[model samples]
Target: PGVWDVAAKDNRGIMDVAVFRLSKKYPRANSVMTHNLPDGGHVRVASGPDGMASIWDYDIVLMGVSHLTEAMNRYRAGLGEKPGRSFRPHVSEILKFCRQSDGGRQYEAVEAALRRLKQTTVEIVRRQRGKDGRPLRVTEGAGLINDYKAVSHEDSGRVTSVEIELPKWLYAAVVEAEHPEVLTMHPNYFLMTPGLGRFVYRLARVAAGKGEARWSFRLIHERSGSPDAFKKSSAGIRELIKANELPEYDLAEEPGQDGPILVMRFRGSFPTPSTDTAGP
Candidate 1:
């Protein structure tokens, strides 16, 4: 758990697989992505009629997570209100939260993103323990969002407000779980340009925390759901290291048994001594 009183950026669950496309380009229609986790866990994302959801579309989920997490934090502190799965926020509020233009095009984009979230399905399977302490496989399959309703202005016909019903899994993880697997994100994350950059920041946030973490480029490529081949994917990682634009983390590369490895070291908002380490 993190400090609940101080204001900060949004939070997201530490999902091991990338459910949304990593690029801005529209994904091919009717595409399905699946990732096999090291511990035999599985994740599958199926596209909807609007095509696979892009990383930009995930901003809405971040908004929902932030709202619910704050509400839960306040409730736990004896606040009168409790968080719920359904969240109703004015459309303008969402736009501002995501740092987007408040105009017709952005509003339409938001509506489209919401529709894709409602239609796309994500299925996850992982091994867990029951009350009896026996190993059991748990499977969850549902859309990114359960449902949504947008109300439009009478004259302008622009969407004024929206009510979003989050998936049970997400709601449970954020509000119901005893120790939620969520982490506070950097405010500049929403302004990131490269899609891979955004994904890597999230990976570092969850895996590295305030320490250092390393992963082979091969594993990152697979987890990223990148359509590029191994060579291209590795090259893209090298480019990321060169660009060095991600906020709150520094990227580097080192030799590995299989290939190159990505080194993510936490550098807080202010500079400090580097605690870099070497190894697998």
Candidate 2:
């Protein structure tokens, strides 16, 4: 019955005949090609429009399946009651080995864990706030407050300026520590903020060796009677000397005393060009 079907050759054509004959001769071969056939059993004929036939052996495929089965069995055995529970024990064993090998470095491990946790927490907070909402504060202290005012000019709509007032005592202390001589040089002294200080220093440098160059110094209250008391005072005097190399100046013993004041003046000229007009 099979041979009759093979000879009938429906849409499958001659390939069916070749497959059937190969199957009959080699029941256990699992594949068939003319080159592998022995002696008289082999048959060669002219190539059809479909061309040559090739076969592949399934030995490697069978071997791969066997290996996969063995691996699955071993994995199941290791899991005991659990089917696929190797991951947790593997990780736990690794951690145990690390701890046993480097017991003294536990502090470093804890610190690393804390840092990771902090980063994750910060990320979560940022995600919760989104872009429009107020951001999370990382520090305990209050941040700086800014007060701005705008002034209008004839040519410009408005120019904005900011007034920043910090803790008075903190500013006073810093000034005292940084420039004590300002106390004796001028009764009324002002300490510029860090940003303004840079501009002031630049102006002072430019005015060097100019007519009556004036410099500003800082003063603090704490150095009332210390040896470094004179340091701040000297800085102020040095600035005054640079102002114009004044031959004579008076220094006061107390902060509020009337003494020599450093004055700075700025002068410039402006000129407009014009063409001559002819009269009729």
Candidate 3:
């Protein structure tokens, strides 16, 4: 259990889990991280110089999912459109989607993120019951992305346009599947900082949905894949709950049988745009 790749304590008991397997922690040095799913699936990620693809990198994945999901829905509505796993988006467009500024440094950061996502390796073992009632294990190893082709400006060699190919697993989950499991994120999500704040927002989105849900601090600590000591991590999470800056959600802590419990409640989403054009 002391191994860096495995959780210090068994986390399989946690009932709420996110579909996306991204690190809640900030980008760190080269290391290997792991997560043990409640359903007995295991994920191992090895990162290099750029570090593991943190939740920030997941922004790109979200964008791709949104694009494909809209395209698929349009096709389903007889819009004469075909949705594919790959997409061509301008670098500026991606930056705007992420709520980031369009600058030379930001462009460099995007390139670095792509590298980290492409270079990081993930090994997954999915356990399931076979037809004969026997345990079956399927192992797969690949990066977060299948491939990324970027077009850069000839004068400055700055990336301009990028075409990204989503992995088969992701493609199947979002576009190819009959019911895509995609969720709508708040626009303010991009304004948040990287770390537990971002991860907890996502956890609330997945676990609580439009209702209230509770999880012990210990469970959150384990599920967060945080390297900090339990006390420190819990303290940080407690602070976050008190601040309650997460968009479309309200967070609070209450006493529980096991130490303290963090509770998340849906605060509803952003307001709809008005068609009223009255002059002030």
Candidate 4:
């Protein structure tokens, strides 16, 4: 009986045909002719106090082997094989077959592969665009409606009022752009400002509906504080506009809830305030 326990323990550890044969040959002195013995091929041997059986059956062994083989196959599939680039073409073929023969799995697989291909292609194109500058068209204009100005007394700084003329098209664009903060400062007069090269660039973007352009300008200033400085600058802007024949607009100054702000009047309607403006 003691040897039976030892044999059971050995069988539990080794779990082999050789160990079973050894246990059967070396029977213990007190061993009863128990049916529940490992040596008896048909009997299920009781190993512990809980009466748990230590049965080494063919079916269990076969199942374990199957599971191990499956695991190895999965590992090899993941690491050993490289995914083929022809996957998309293959998937497309399968999808065609599915459409013709009504195979659901093939159709689904093809759809998924096509989606993945599209995403990958978009990413590649985006990367290429980032490396290169965005393809955009640029338009240049000499003069554009920037700001309004009037003559001011050198002593009192009171504005000697003057009316400004704005182009219809320029007015429409400015109104559409919605710049209002430009008028809030309430300078005495509408200043003839330089052609806004940068503003023109942004406007070009709006016009083209893609990419961006940059504008640069050179300005002539008589004196820093002279009220006439704006008036003089206006002449240059006017000349540029006239030479370019660019459509211009009027930026009307009005009182806002916060303070004075410029409004763009295009056609009959006054649009929203512009975000782009110079100065406080």
Number of the top candidate by lDDT? 1
Residues 10-109, model 1: lDDT tens digits: 3345444688888877564578888886668788889877888787888888877777767776686676498779988888788887778899888878
Which candidate order results from sorting by TM-score in descending order? 1, 3, 2, 4
Query: Which 10 consecutive residues of model 4 have the lowest summed lDDT?
Result: 2-11
For model 1 the local lDDT of residue 226 reads 93
Model-by-model lDDT, in order?
0.78, 0.23, 0.69, 0.24
Residue 105's lDDT in candidate 2: 48
lDDT of 3 by residue, 219-248 (tens): 887777677789997888888977889988
Which prediction has more favorable TM-score, 3 or 4?
3
Question: What's the C-alpha lDDT at position 45 in model 4?
Answer: 22
User: TM-score: which candidate is best?
Assistant: 1
lDDT (10s digit) by residue, model 4, range 1-280:
1100110001011121111011212222211111212322222121212111111111111122222222223344563342211111232232222223335453443333222222211000111223367753322221111222334457754333322232233233222223311111111111212223212211322222222222211111211111234555445434544444222333333445543332222222212123212111
Give the better candidate number (2 or 3) by TM-score.
Answer: 3
As a whole number from 0 to 100, the lDDT of residue 86 in candidate 3 is 82
Q: After superposition, how far is residue 124 of candidate 2 from its true place, in Å?
A: 34
Q: Please list the residue runs of candidate 3 whose C-alpha ends up more than 4 Å from where it truly belongs after superposition.
A: 1-26, 270-280
Model 2 misplaced stretches (Cα beyond 4 Å) = 1-230, 240-257, 268-280
